[model samples]
Target: MRLFRSLDYATDADPNWAGSLLADGTLPSFRGGYVGISALRNSDVLTAVSIIAGDVARFPMIVEDKAKETIVPLENVEYLLNTKVNGRLSAYQWRFAMTVNAILTGNSYSRIVRDPLTNEPSMLEFYAPSQTEVDTTDPNHVVYRFTPYNSGYTIVCQQEDVLHWKFFSYDTFTGRSPLLSLGDEIKLQEQGIGTLKSFFGGGLKGSVLKAKGKLSADARKKMREDFERAQSGAASGAPVVVDDTVEYQPLEVDTSVLNLITSNNYSTSQIAKALRVPAYRLAQNSPNQSVKQLSDDYIVNDMPFYFEPITTEAEMKLLDDEQRHKFKIEFDTSKVSGPSVQDVASMKTNGIIVGNEARQKLGMKSIDNPDMNRLESNLNTIWLDQRAAYQAAKAATKGGDAHEGNSHDDNAD
Candidate 1:
């Protein structure tokens, strides 16, 4: 991996030539267009995106040393990701923004800043997907072209100098947004909302007034004004006293008749399906779901798609070959396990995780006691051989007591 990369200031490479470089092949030379953040206007979209991204951001990323079975913290990368990512964003803010960008736009990019003398990473600078482009013309050395926000110039970077996170992707380079395929559903939902707003705003109330015969324009105008005046404000619930020449007929505009409520619910479910989010996560709750069951389903089914991409890309881009062989980077998923008190106690008693490890998951400080670091079965049934020996010793003690009693009885006779 290249530890140091200088920004290429004098390159004449046109930004238009940028393309995505996949491991197997290349994609079309175009910037993966940015989907507007306005998509959050949809309630379901906002909820789905927030639940996934917020949970992701809440989980901490750590580098684990497989050889030593311990965590090795890198102040540059780990601290930046867990505490502060850059000058402008906190760890949570950075993660949330990047995830939102990836989910909405299908790609997120950040430049890795490294120290000149030590050749260690120092900062991670974020770039909007729209501000970054990839040039895959060279199969061996893929290039990144980044235009800084509100800046007039573009900085050309080597593949090693930037971190790219992608969502669901077919070509492995440019990710496909969930909204891309659900365009019709989103449009219909938005239109439905607009219709509701207009219907209520206009105060139509699904009623039409008819005249007995063709009336003059002046008469029609006066009648409409009088009708609106009577229907609004103080006279809203009162009966309208119209002349015999006019008749009122009520049209069916109930939500059930129009299928408005059901249609909106179906659209929301479709949006959730498209995003691979559980419907309950978007406030579409089912009849009888235990919290534990829902939490497990979320972690097992929905979360891997959101978590693995970022961690895998981070491991590849952040760690060098030697470090990667000895260490791995991952999020501490147990934090979001939503385990009950009984479940957590069982884990401890079974020696699945040590005290400090469990405490870390609970966001508590580690105890300094040696017992806290040890993993021991609370039931004293650790190994099969030990259990067998314990049972044998108990039987021998009982047999000895019986023999003693028999000897005492023989002596008395």
Candidate 2:
């Protein structure tokens, strides 16, 4: 929400205090001591010292002799004074290290720019503190503050671009009070969070978007099938022909009639009849003309010309190969639908037309054939024969009784 714009070094009223630490004679003892003055003279060191001193004093120090006596009194001391100075310096150094470490370790604040034209968020810019510029407790190090350039507009950095920073009441320098130095600005720019001008485009803007789901299984399968078909068609060298014969014809009766015949898939006689032209005239005209000329004339004159001549040997071979391939494909497809002839013959001898259509129609179930009518006829024949035999046997049994009665009558005669 908050954006930073420019980075300027923290201003100092007496810049010499920061520079004097570098002089060998300024604090000879402190320079050669365990904690050398030069060691704490760095930008990070000065910033740390200043931060700890707050608004009270510019240089705070403490000196203890080997006898545990105060070597430099707090008030009378000219070069080194109290312990508060060292504490302020140390605190500034510590805080700077922490901030720089966080930035270096990818723990910095970042925001993305949205592209209004694309309606999408662009790239992000991150604020990264530099180790060299970081003085955790340095008061002399330059710290930035957001000031209103205009009455209502605050000048802030929006990813190195001069864009208004939205969603925040104040700028980056106004909130949280993070200590920064001149080196910090350099490091921040180096880490890709410098100024708004350095940013390529105002960072991410627009709207958040989501990706659509993957294609359906059936759609994928269809696409693959189409691809295979197209590859096969290309490999086979099949001619790419568009049937647009009618479009070339003129509006005149002859051309219109000829084009109509040629555009349709019709025989010569059918074409002649449809066009109201005599078949003999077509026959007479065909013998004297080349197929190309005939087709061109038919298309121009609107005549029906279905047959295309094989002009080249390559074309003829390609056509022949395509036809043979199609035939083989169809034959193989049909073979999978039925059993072999041997299986049919074996079933027939067993009084079972296993693959017969009639059996399937009658609902008689069989793995080889599903016909039902034939099964009904077979069952009817078997039942009729059984019934006839039963009747004949019953008649014979009655005949014996009849014969005995007849013999008694003969003796009486």
lDDT by residue (1-413, candidate 1, tens digit) is 11112446213433323222211112322222213475687778888889888988998888877875556766667887799877888989989988988887677788988879876677888887667766655657878878776667778889888888777888665665677666677777767877777767654556778998888999989988888777767444456667787898766566673574445587888888888888887778654888778788878788888888988788887777888788888787665575665766678879998887667656455688999888858665657768888888999999999999999999999
lDDT of 2 by residue, 1-413 (tens): 11222233223332332332222122333223212233233333334323322311221222223232212232322221122113233323332333332211212222233356842333323322210112112343322213322344422333222111111113222111111212333233223322333332322211122223566878666655554454453433334322332112112223454344334323334434433233344443444666655543433333111111101211222123433333211001112224445665556545654344322223223344335223332343445568989888889989998999999999999
State the displacement of the C-alpha of residue 93, model 1, in Å, after optimal TM-score superposition. Answer: 1.3
Q: What are the Cα lDDT values of the candidates?
A: 0.73, 0.31
Question: Superposing all C-alpha atoms, what RMSD in Å does each candidate have to the true structure?
Answer: 6.7, 44.2
TM-score, prediction 2? 0.13
Per-candidate TM equals 0.77, 0.13
